[model samples]
Target chain A: MLHMLEKTIADNPLITAFAFVGVVIWVSNQIGRHLTGGRVAGSAIAVLGGLALAYWGGAVTGKAKGLADIATFSGLALMGGAMMRDFTIVATASEVHVDEAKKAGWLGVIALLLGTVLPFIIGVLVAWSFGYTDPIALTTIGAGAVTYIVGPVTGAAIGASSDVMALSIATGVVKAIMVMVFTPVFARFMGLSTPQSAMVFGGLAGTVSGVSAGLAATDRKLVPYGALVATFHTGLGCLLGPSVLYLAVKAITW
Target chain B: MVIFGTALLAACYLAGIWVGEAIAVLIGVKANVGGVGIAMIFLIAAQHFLKTKGLFPADTEKGVTFWAMMYIPVVVAMAATQNVVVAIKGGPIALLSAVGSFLLCFGVVALINRSMQRHASPEEADASAALASAPDALKSR
Candidate 1:
């Protein structure tokens, strides 16, 4: 019986992966409700918990893929791969209504610009303070502060080394998670209720997944608006990062 | 369950990625630029088109919701894939930059909201506007 179950689990890795995530989510939700008293979202806790587990996995296995590197959870690598990531991103748009999203007008454009530029400046400043004087590294990491996608795109465009590009991606990923966790926590203080504010916030937030997740937590209606505007960040960041932003950073440093 | 919309989603995803790749190539980057966002746009357009044609089935929403509710799990899975230990070991700069940028940006966003409130966009003052007081907003789909 045990051998049969083991073979079944081994053969159906995706199902096993779903089961594992299911249990993690169930427990996390209970903890969120009972322990946190619904102050912190269960989903947020699950993501953080997953990160912690991944950190532990890396510490123990000395591998970079996190929990996906483990043999039993090997299915996680596939489940969390680019295909699934992009698919899930695409799928969530199912609920979005176009007419409603059209509410964000030119104000959204300004928000998107400020959202992209502000973070890039902060990123460049931090890199500068950290003693990174190279134009390519500074631009790449600053682009990363915009979004994980922007980071690599800028890095590749400006000839940043692979290590620097990786760092930029890491920076972007951390920023995404932070946005996701903090969006709901601070939603009330920020007047994140209306479609207009959501659009503006999405512009300033500057990440599709992070903003989508955050807005979804705050208000389902706001997700499409925030995500609609937030989607522009990458293209704007990618355009500005390698050219205008890089030049500004280089003018002062180089 | 009909489990519809997957085909539409896959088609949109592929189109978005192809266009994203083309954009990246045009700009001299080796990555798929805005593929996910583009895919989402395509999805939205396609759904709208389908609805106009009356080809959009009401039951299709079920399929979409099935995947949509799985969003948090997907996020968790994605988070689990990141090797946080190695990222931290890369240096403090990456972490510091992220935190500092977030702090400043959040402050700026708050300022934007405060200014908006000072002007008071009619519905915003409706006592239920607060996230906690708004029952419907809190009930996430």
Candidate 2:
């Protein structure tokens, strides 16, 4: 029976992938509820679980793409590919109402711009401190500070080394995890109880998952408002990271 | 009716991809011009237009919302499987830079928030104070 199940899963990669994700989500939710008393978002826990699984898979298979390296889990690569990423992003955007978004007003816009530029600057400085003196590496790492998505995008654009690009991504992920863990704890101190404030928080935080999970822990209703502006941060970071920011870093470094 | 909404989403996504590609070409860049961003803008605009025209059905909105909710879980999954293995192998610089940036960003945000609060009008401050005291108010949709 076990052999039959293994063969079935190996043959139906997509089905196995879905089932694997389902189990992960279930276990993560269980951990969230029981361990953290739902103070941590299930999504956050699930992500941690997924990361653990990825590491374990890599160790077991000694291949890139982590779990996708496993024969039966090859469907994971496709499932988590850009197509699905873009699709999910679009779906999330579809939920935004323009009239409602306008309520964030100019404060949110300032926050969004500041959020992107400030993070980029800090990222660049940090990269410089780390001895990445080349403009391309600096810009890519700096962009990664804006968001993991921006890091790879900028690195690919300017031809940063794969190692630098990976560092950039790591930087972004660490920032994201910090945002996820700290948002609720700081929500009160930050005055994030209002929709407008939530919008600004989203812009400043600039990680969709982090802001969403943070807001979910703080106030479920604020998730949409926060996520709305946070979504724009990615676009703004992408636009600026490879162009304006890159040029500025180049002018300095060169 | 739900199928119509799904079709609209697909249309918006395709238009977004086209626009993103066109912009990238115009800029003479090899990278994508953020198709997801363009597609989102298109989706939002289309949804607004449809609503304004009163052509959008309630059922369609429900369908769209359902799909949008589903996307969050997908993101959680993506977050979990990102390139930690490579990042870890990249050396201590990666971890240090990440930690440094995280701290700097956090401190800056806190400072900015404090300054903004200090500059708030007395009435706005009062309102925020009340809101803070009763977070249940924030939880209601």
Candidate 3:
């Protein structure tokens, strides 16, 4: 059974990742609902789903690769935790004075602009350092995901956990649409292979999901849960890393 | 990595808000205040809807539904795009940017709330005092 399971995952990384993510999501939702007696459990489920995916994915994929992948996964897990901390601090803070609403609105606008621009600039720089061609497209996709998913998740989480179900559904749907619509455009823009493009986009989705979950969490207690979700997602990606790598190599070689 | 998308999403939301605001202005709609009034209306509507549905008390499914809807597009995008490497590399930058923007908005709002509290009118203060004293008075009686 173990051999068969390994073979199945080896042959179908995408399917495995999808199945793993789905299962985690469902289980987390059920557990969260049971515990909180509210829908905030969905968010908790998202967090747990991400973590479980990462852990299982990592364990499966890291078997022959030694500890490097494990270390990377661990690092990502830490970062995920850190991201949650920042979100918690900001969420717990009191709302601005009523008189400052206008100021806040203006500031929000400014923040929005900066949020869009700064990441692109940084991504471009990073890509350039790595000698990657046409970093702009990658940057755009990355920044766009954050703007769309992360902000709302954080806003919803901090302000109201009730928003989680709606946000999750909306995000999932939008992301699916964007992936179908934008991937080809991005592929042409970046002149990247399909696999490369897919990996980049998938990574973007995972990151946004993780960060959004972190930002949306109200209680400090939930940070670990959120981090665990991210870790799981990352692990799943890593576990399937070899298959993805094989596909990329084949595409490049061909 | 998907954090990058936050910018685009924010742009979309802002665009939606702008359109809403423009329509209101074009129609010559008047309110006690401008943006806040609009936002307050939305907030109240959301709160009322939740309360009416009994989802605000011990029920949170409605809110969860809202989040799930938002995530649908996101998940679709993920599924469509097969690339995971670029996302992993770029995820942190995108997340940080989004968080920064959110904090700026949140902090500004908090400051506004504080200012409003500080600038309360004497009449408003007296009215609040009366309201607070009334409950105690009733208890004493």
Candidate 4:
């Protein structure tokens, strides 16, 4: 069992990336909290750290197809940030005291679980609709989006700054793992020559979604609305991300 | 924006106290801690507005209770994440980092508090000293 586990981890680049990102997020949050006296500051720092990591990873990997992909990722991040800001306002406006609010303890838990898991289910359904046999790419992307975006947004809405940082780390780890595991799977699914590159793009999409969600949760009003906006933003980003990669490859070849 | 909001809230609360005092005199109301009480209410309300009511329970009293709940999740998450990172990084490094971070932040806050205390007028200091001492009496009793 130990040998098998080790092999699985070694073979799975996504898992390694996930672990790396998680560590980075956790450390950054701790540092930010110590410095800022608030979760908002910690979260902001984590987002900035994530961006730096992405840039470093891209450069180190030497797989970046072009400058356009980086620009696209940055643009997506800005859009996501704007969407989150709107969500924060709405969530803030709707704030209520815990005692007066109806406690949906178990129901709330169920709702949370459903919210986190539904994206993957939906992604699989979409992939099936598109006649894709392997749902790995969609699943990875969906999971990344849900975990990163919803976890932080809800954390903030509920005033869970520490949770936001922790969740961000967890989501980052998950996304990294997804990138490693699904890269080859997605390449095969799409009949692409470079599967690893596709995985990286998918990971980028997840990070973008997470950052967007974090920004939205900084204020209460942003929750539900931010989620909707993120969905659209990520959807478009995922579609365009690959196209940008293709153009980069073509440009390089020319 | 957040810093500005915090400052604005503080100003409004102070203004509320001044206004409350004027109203008290105009209506021939009792003096003493009543003005302070009115000020506190205004301060709490302002905090509620600044932090947003959504961050707390709907029925929460506008005071420490609200702040406690608001900060609980943040603390828990931070502690958990910090622990996880430390565990991952192994023993000594993680321990040092966590302890160091805490001490560093604590020292900074302590220094600020000390500076404020030193700058306070004698009368203000005496009142604050009495207030501080009063808490011990209540606790002992």
lDDT tens digits, residues B1-141, model 1?
Answer: 335677777788799778877876886654555665677778888998999898878787566656656766865676676667755655677798889888877888888877987888566555225422222211244
Residue-level lDDT tens digits of model 3 in B81-123? 2222223344444334334333332343334334545676787
The lDDT ranking, best first, is 1, 2, 4, 3
lDDT for model 3 comes to: 0.32
| Model 3 vs truth, CA RMSD | 19.5
DockQ of 2: 0.37
Query: Number of clashes in model 3?
Result: 108
What fraction of native interface contacts is shared by candidate 4?
0.00
For candidate 3 chain B, the 10 contiguous residues with the lowest summed lDDT are B132-141
Candidate 1, A2-61: lDDT as tens digits:
989888878887778888888888988898778866545566567667767777777788
- In model 1, the Cα lDDT at residue B60 comes to 72
TM-score of each: 0.74, 0.81, 0.30, 0.22
In terms of lDDT, the poorest run of 10 residues in model 1 chain B is B131-140
What does candidate 4's lDDT look like per residue over B1-141, in tens digits? 334443443454456446645754664533211222233345445556645645443242233333322222222222222213312322232123222322232233234334444575777545434322211110100
Model 1 residue pairs with clashes: none
Each candidate's lDDT (Cα)? Answer: 0.73, 0.71, 0.32, 0.33
Ranking by DockQ: 1, 2, 3, 4
lDDT of 1 at A248: 69
Give fnat for candidate 3: 0.00
Candidate 1 positional error at A14, Å = 1.7
Superposed model 4: Cα runs more than 4 Å off: A1-41, A44-48, A60-104, A125-132, A149-254, B1-141
Q: Is candidate 1 or candidate 2 better by TM-score?
A: 2
